[model samples]
Target: MTTAAMPATPADPGAAEAADVTGRLDALDDMLRLGGGRLDPRLLDEAGALLDRAGERLRLSGEHTVVTLAGGTGSGKSTLFNAICGLELSPTGLRRPMTSKAHACVWGLDGAGPLLDWLDVDKRHRYARASALDTARSDTSLQGLVLLDLPDHDSIRAEHRAEADRFVTIADLLVWVVDPQKYADAALHRDYIVPFARYAGVTLIVLNQVDRLQPEEVDDCVADLRRLLQAEGLADPRIVTASAASPDGVLGFREVLVDTVAARRARAQRITTDLDRLAERFAGQSGADEPPAGVPAPARAALVEELTDAAGAPAVAEAMESAYELRAADFVGWPVASLADRLRSDPLRRMRLGELREELRNAFTGPVGAQQGDVDNALAAVAETVTGTLPPPWARAVRAAARRHAGELPEDLGEALKDALPTFNQVPRWWWLIKTWQYFLVLATALCVLWIGLLVAYGVFGAGGDGANGLIGDAGLIPYVAVLAVCTLGMGYLTNLACRNMVALQSANHGERMERHMLDSIERVAEAKVLKPIADELAVYAQFRKDAAALRG
Candidate 1:
């Protein structure tokens, strides 16, 4: 037997709607976090209030929908409210102004007490539609409805108007009751309709007390009101005409309410509409999205170069080269010349580079102050490169990130240079070998000079004596001794020439190596302190844009 799989259970729209609301809230929070310092403060506060209001509303029963009746004096708002509830719930009179406190008539009051409390309606003013005494179940279609009768919107008392405005904002559905006489009042259109154009989907424009108008006049008035609403940017506004004094006074409104309550979307729709409006406001402040490409290679290199110069890298490297040459001179110079070389100071030592750590710290504190301008320029250049395509606010954020840790920049560069410079204490084997050869040549030259001096003395003091005869055989050898002394000195001179050539080659290599090390060290510092921060700011902007887009959606 073939068994058919049951159709997948349809998704619970309520759960999905709740999840969507949650996602939007999360996105709004992210936008706030990323944009707190960059965006307008007042707008952020409004967004925060919306978040709190939405959360509080969600915490209450999503099953119930709050519908508010708002209208100016003599609009028969309370009469229409009583008619909808099928009872005299809210007081109606010919007085100039009506109730200041709102009255709530709730249907299916199970799980609705907390919601009513949240609305802050006085308990004495609250009424229930679905009681045990009602056996006919006539209000079944209006179950889960929290109907509120608010004070007249144009009440003379400021507190009453304020109270009406507060409830109007949080209500899921708004039934704006207007009699034909005051339907075109500027206060109604300006303060309520024009400002709430975005909420037209949940709004109802009821032309109440229309019994006074002829049927043709009612059509014309409704048509004129519709034109006014459309001009005010409300799209396809829903308009119903009724007379609270008639037997079937609010039948049309009841039908709309039943459909609205059954759909169970008014609450979600209300908050979502609020979020949509807020998201659009936020979007106005944010510009086009520019993906973060990080710091450009040229910018990075330029920053390193600037910092390397500020840290005195070139000077130190040159000093290292000169110091090598000086040491070579001391090791390979002729004995007397080597003593003179010792009298000259070592180049690196003259710069106080032997105590690298302390010297650099002091230099950065003092001499390095002159290079602060260069450092600032380099940072600005990098920030400009990174933020060139960003919006003004985000660009400012990126620039601020670049300079946030700038005070530490000079010291950081100094430390990098300190670690890069080589210690000159290590002597190459070739230097030692060349020094030993020079020592041997010096000893030979000294012996040859001594031989020539002795020969000269004997010839002068004992020319005809036995010593002279003994020395006579060596008389011709004096010239040879003299030549030998001259040859030994020339050989010593050649050794000195070779040592100079070798020191020159090694010194050049040493300088180049030192410069390379300095560059590498500077690159690392630039990446850690400057480039990384810029990239982080860009990332924040990118993420914020994504979240804000979600909110807009």
Candidate 2:
């Protein structure tokens, strides 16, 4: 609602206006409840703003009394059009009109393109000396007023017929120009006046070429035209017997233009009415009052859900599980030697412990695990390659969610990966071969360790109780051999532990660092890459809507 200095008194006009504005504002609320796609949602909002502008323009049009000089060929309409422009602006409508004489003259402010366009006029009149007119005459009341010199309304050409239709859309005043002979012609009443019967109050009829009509015939022709106009629904349409060749009704038409339609109050009312129409269109799209700060609640949920589904959560979880298992084996595989070392040493292993879980998840799966710390971390490096890649709104929400839930990585690391996303679990073709080789290495290492152990045991126990033909070659030397063997086996075991544990720890540490970097990368993208730009664009749209509305008002 608007508040002005004039107020307090209930009957004050200013207060009434404020109340009216409040009413329209309240009406806007009802429109936004209906929502759907961007076509219905975003598109509608913009269309509404445009409509508001169109309506405001319409009001500006209303203040000008349009007195079109219309007639058949050689009816002196062009001459009359010139006379009208003698006090108006250039006469553009007659530039190439079929009449071979002058027709309509339009008068208004400089920004008359929209109005002329609405009238389907490719050319229109503008004041060449308007600046001088302002200095020469102090009156500024004619700013929105327009006068037209039209082509023959009865022209055989379809193009001429089209011009008439165009004028009616934008004209607030219509002054029909006819000669004495055709003033009461059936073609005029049936073709033109009858169609605009509903707008009779703004219609005026002019009979040109009255100089040729005898005094009695003039009254008769005027009376016949009046009766015809009445039957066509212009019950009280003004009939002014005019002569462009002489000087009869021209001054009266000019007087009406300056006095009634061009009056300030009339101009303002027209503008206000046009604004009402534009507001109505806008309100229907955006919320009638104020649009919600963002997408509507229902729309927001739908969009987020749609985005999450597209992110492929299941895939990320699978990838994480594989990563965790491989990493864990390396951390604890010292007894089996390579088992622990290989798993722990893999670059993919260390990321989950730090921030690499989400990144790994995302790389192995898809955006589904972007919210997961491991996946987020894993994607950091990948994000750099696609600098401007923007995530859907839902993806941002999911990433934020993953950050909040990142603590779970350490506790439920395996399960988290399994449930995180399905896409991540699908290993590449090369990884399949690698996994097969991992199993083969584990089996081969086990077999070699067992064979070596058996050979040493047989050597120690080979000196049988009989001490003859012994498998290891001597019972008396058994104790000495056993002692030597114990030392060698102990040394081998220690070497194995040190080799696996030390190497595994170094690899895991490096992996963790990489994972942390990956997470940083993904986080930066969720913000700088996607969220910021979308927010900025949406804000611009909102502001545009507001500015358009204010201008219309």
Candidate 3:
């Protein structure tokens, strides 16, 4: 059958009562799902979370409602769900599924629990508490009113089962529908009713569509049904007659529901009585003295930090900052035997330079950050932190310089991280190291080029051997690199130089940005993002504890 909402009324007090009762049912359902009675702190924390979100809403809006209907399919539950709410319905649509899917949630008004989110839903309808019965418009019901509707309880989907099971468990006032045909369905009694018998007092069992029998013999069938419930160990279960299609037995059934003489005695209390019980339950949960059933503050805080850090967002964001300073430097060539090797170490020089800039920024920011200045030094320090010790900076510097000069960032990256991770304790190291290394290398190479020119002017320029000395001094290109792809390599080297100078300045300004990002993420993880839910839970527990204490007093 297609679902349609209740028609608006002049002053619908019926729905106001609905909100209060439905909200309480929602609260109980939330508690059950969150494992409120268990030691699993995560579930309890979630429970505490639920309490905080709905507290104000509970207090202000739906505090005067009664019975809430929920059950499974083939249980004749939809016919029963509608009978309880007393909402009229049309025949099923042409292509309705044998098992309904969309939940037909009928509350006297807006419900109490975070039912929407748990449903993974975003409801666009507006539902608010009507201040008075006369003011109650469409769905809003008054105290002692009942809400009815079908749930897609028997759907193949797990989500549907969860939704139905959850709603059934939480309702302060609930009805379980069973037909004569499938009255003994194990899923109904075992999956829903039996385990929740602790809540049987608020329950109603309806033998719906009983009008199919001889009208005069309805009483005998209802009697046999009551005996079955008694066999099920339900206390004085209230059995009602309902027919969605016929509409004859429903009015009588509705009166019994609102009058509250069902299976349990609690339903008899007016909607206000139920609301008071709820306020009592939640108020206790909210108090400072309440048991710490919700999330521990520290754990929640930590989780938030972890999530933020996962993005590496802080460092990326902070690098947009700037700082600058200048200093003089010198370069010199080594022995001819080592000449090729030394020139090849051009990348090492850039690495060292980048390391320097990063350290400077760290110094500027404060304690605990990425330090720039000599990759040898910082790498050693970080390595020590990661592995407890590493080679000294000077030795590392020498080794770096000793590496094949042909090394380029993209080529060496894989190996560098391999070394950095296990030995140096670097996680996510390659990109940063490669970037820093490139910037530092180009700057050093440029400076080295300038040094060769100075040396030439002093002695090597005018005194040439077979034009080789003059060639080396004048062009200032490494002899071998110049021989093959010199122009391409030269352009790379020159562009690298320009880019390095700019990056060097940029790094100087923003070197600690990464470290800052990591630190701030940790702090927020400890504080706001993580702590918010936990603190909220603690607050609920406190309020609950206080209320419990007051009740005890």
What overall lDDT goes with each candidate model?
0.82, 0.48, 0.44
User: Model 3: which ten-residue window has the lowest total lDDT?
Assistant: 325-334
Index of the highest-lDDT prediction:
1
Clashes of 3: 51
Question: Mind giving the per-residue lDDT tens digits that candidate 2 earns over 1-553?
Answer: 1366327524422334344443443333223322213224554575455345434444334324444555565566666666645553333344445442223344555555555555444453433223233333334333445566666766777777667655644455666778866666677778777866655655667777687978998888888888878877877878776665555456655555555443433323333444455555454333223322333345333433322322433343344444554544433333344546556786644555445546664453322233454434533322222222222332333234324434433233333333433343443353344435444544555554554454455544543334434434433544554555455445445654554465456545544544444343333434443334434434433554564465345
Q: What is the TM-score of each candidate against the true structure?
A: 0.89, 0.40, 0.36
- Give the C-alpha lDDT of model 1: 0.82
- Return the TM-score for candidate 2, rounded to 2 decimals: 0.40
* Poorly placed runs, candidate 2 (over 4 Å): 1-67, 73-98, 103-150, 157-174, 178-203, 207-290, 295-315, 318-322, 333-552
Ranked candidates (lDDT, high to low): 1, 2, 3
Candidate 1 per-residue lDDT over residues 102-218, each given as its tens digit: 999988888899998988999999999874423453443787889999998999999999999999999999989999999999999999999999899899999998889888898
In model 3, which regions exceed 4 Å deviation? Answer: 1-43, 46-57, 63-68, 80-148, 215-217, 260-553
